[model samples]
Target: MHTLFSSNILSPPPAPATQQNPFELLFNSAATSNSTASASNSSAHSSPIEYNLLTRRLQDERRATEDARHVEPTAVRRKGHPKLLLMGQRRSGKSSIQNVILQKMPPTETLYLESTNTVKTVSMQSFAQFEMTEVPSQLSIESPEIAYSEANFRELGTVIWVIDVQDDYLSSINSLVHTAGFLAENYPRVHFEVFIHKTDGLSEEYRYDAFREVRQRVQDELSDVGFGHREVAFHQTSIFDHSIYEAISKVVQRLLPQLPALEALLNRLCSTCGMQKAYLFDTASKIYIATDASPTFLKDYEVCSDYVDVIVDIKALYGWQQPAKKPAGGSDADDEGIGESVVTFERNGDTYIYAREITEHLSLICLMGKGSGIDKRVLIDYNVSLLQDAVVEVFKV
Candidate 1:
């Protein structure tokens, strides 16, 4: 709730003013003298000199104080979970897979072309007891403006490509491959997961055969693009099948260990902002942190220069007080400026409570040091426990 700006400069107090009456009398006298002198020197000298010696001295001192302040290089060690992106053709069961993984149906529907126009993000606590972000197809493909925003892609850890096994559209395959190519080109270091969704639609015999064929097609396409078949992992999934859920759990277990901290930071922000989804803007980082919370206080949150790793709260902005009210019909709320809270923490810094609420979901983003060099999965598990405790505290208060 508190943000500290570390500045060495101590602005000087204003110069003491002389007694008003006395100062006025002196000014009057000076003016009279100056006028008389000007008349006397009219034929010889020009106007009397107007000097502000005190003002000049004050300005010089202020500049010197600013110059004296040092710019120390401080490292920011952020500790959080990974960002996961889900993508696939229309109605490829991407949302269904997300529901299975998150262990809850999305507040919205999961159908063909249901997300034809926008991208959606779901924040959840996985069975693995780790915080994970599920980016649905709506927000990924339909809304290009939001999808490629700097905030959207910067924290992304893994891109999960879901495919419907029952749909035999070759064009869908091409689109999927192209999407992968685009992502790989943009984010070479990010990991990937290709899910063959809707496995329940096919019979046991056809399911296995289709799964194998889909895997082969993905492998061939990836290989053709020079992305080795081994680089990607494939999964056969059906939201109705418990076994599919178990398989996904295993995949997440293996991948969770490699997730980065920014992902966790984002999930916390989304949950706090009450935004069903958000796209990141890199330029916004210049003024604010890379992540965004919904119900945007303004259109963006800026970074506070006082602290190297601190984001400025929207309330602190020059003009950000009233927030926009939610629209009727339970539609998503529009982001105004930045939200009231600012998320700040340093890597290797002391543990602090960072919590926010989006609608009913409460999340806490914490920073952990390298004291133990703990495994990534282990770190996530620990943070999830901390988040739950923090949420409970929010309700208690």
Candidate 2:
């Protein structure tokens, strides 16, 4: 991997000098996991370390306000987060989505846009385990260093190619298709996902049409290039709606190997609880990490997302209403955070929503049939305890 690095400006961190090094703890596990996967086919395979990223980060604010951030050509200060690169044309809202997801920047801030000129890496650990790097649109992928670096990585990366959904650019589509095809073919281990961005301002019908048009065209091009439809995934993402967060969750979930087990546990919970569906949602972003086996309708996600908002908003209002009970050295899980939440409201007279707190950062939302003849609350409460243990065991891996 050092052969691909001219400088350690954006390289992964080194080993721990002390036992308390958090960076080492975080990235060392990544390196260990990378070594475990052995390719069955004689395809190109390099170390599966997360350093060889193909994703983008938010441009440094100082640079966004002045000039684009400069990629510091210095030695590595610490081991880095797994990397994801943003590769796209001009004004594609790459920096905006990067900022919202990584920096927790408000979506409103992205309205005042500025062009970036250099590659920038930003630290992000709250969501996924990757410190994303954003390459400038002006940076040519034809660069030997980038191509060589990409060719050497072994981990399955997520490439979110941002597309300006509002624009009419045949040339951009041509460029996008060609680059996507080339990368998907060469980097079989990498996931190439297309984001039809900045569609929030459009009408719902128009947005769907726009996404469909772009998706079909991209798929057609990939088919012509001798690739299957499943080779690439397309998402309609925008900062204004929950779609972006949902799309990002899908991208991040691809990187999480523990998700399948979690989903399996969720499926068991759903079946055992006599519920129609169950969702394991991330509290910070309101994005579901896993769910039950039932086909997830858009209505389900939106409804559960709103249900989470209700839980959070109520907690914010009444969190101070209760007296204090503090824990010892560990963090407090109760006071402001939800210990339990239950509400049964009719949606379509016969359908209802049932939500409960699982962990501090995870929640379970179950859609139930009104006439199941079972005590759902009791069953769900009992299963939540088991689900909690399963969640712990899954992440412990």
Candidate 3:
């Protein structure tokens, strides 16, 4: 029996300080006034010092405004939702099975191909209580290379191998088993569900025989690998059958308990936060960050809800100006390199910071002037601490 559980188990982190300080606002207002004065005196022949002072003051005022409006550090948690990866040759009724599981027609038709060219993700909201993400047909068993390379498959919770009993390939269960083996190796923890779909087209006797044969084949393969008979489960399902839905629901119920933490994190992040997207960054590589952009946010930000994390160094990538540094030992002759700015927050007696250049990627709308080189490593380290603090504080785990 599959157990269904709510993914929204984690609580949202504390809201960051939204309001700006009065002094900061006043300084900005004064800077604007100075800019106005400078512009008015532009026609008069102003000395180089006056002109330089005005320009520098204006730049400072702009930087201060940006800093004041900057967004506070926030971390998003990836909730464990029941992700089902469908596998099998093309035209195996895979899409039809997905439609039934989702209780709606598939967003698009499944296609037949020798190999998958790209990986696709579909989020079904019909099961709002439990999130469901479906792997696109392009990366199914028919396209082994694409399936193996797709990053989305790494996070799947279950592999639903859909087979068309009437198709010519139905006689051979080897392909299906091989796909299952691939999934088992890549995602060892994910469960397996073999659905002998298109049973509606088969006679009652033949359907039963096909189902039994496929089930036995899968079991034998599993037993050969030293895994017990209980490792895999088979279901004879058709789009027309209502009981198939029940079977799917039951499977979900059984798997929920094993992934409480992941489910809780996702639920909290999706429900309480104004932003529907969050990212996970790899500290060592300074790359491999993941984000799920809701449909609404996708238009503005070309991000998807799928676990697509792009690797990049925020400072070097964004071209933020480095802050100038004073000599460490008061040696006027020695010039120290500039340092990068990072956001910081404290949680559970631990301080964490996430250092990234303020850019469109992070929704930082302010403009920063170019300056000396800031230490990229320092900024990255601080930002990492900030992220850790946010996660620990918000999730309490």
Winning candidate number (TM-score): 2
lDDT (10s digit) by residue, model 3, range 1-397: 0111122212233334432211112222445545544543441333345444534444454445455546422212113455666666666765565554454443233332233334444554221223344444445453655455545454455767767777765444666666666656665556887777777778978889988877776788766764544467777776564434534644553343212222222222322222233333222211112232232222222221111112223333443343323322111111243222333233422222222322112211101112211343343333333433333332222
Off by over 4 Å in 1: 1-79, 106-116, 125-147, 258-397
TM-score of each: 0.41, 0.68, 0.39
Put the candidates in lDDT order, highest first: 2, 1, 3
In TM-score terms, candidate 2 sits at: 0.68
Give the per-residue lDDT digits (tens) of candidate 1, residues 1-397: 0111112112234323322111011111234334434332231211112112222232343333233332322211112344566777767766666554454453234443244444556564321123344444444432555455655565565777777777775766787777677777776545677777777778889888887887788779878987653467777766664444434443443343211122333344334323333322211111121232233322112122222123323323433433433321111113442122324245733332232222222222222223322334344444444434432322221
**Candidate 1 steric clashes:** 28
lDDT of 3: 0.42
Model 3 ranges with Cα > 4 A deviation: 1-78, 106-118, 126-154, 170-172, 225-230, 258-397
Model 3 / residue 201 / CA error / Å: 1.9
The residue-level lDDT of candidate 1 at 135 comes to 46
lDDT of each: 0.42, 0.60, 0.42
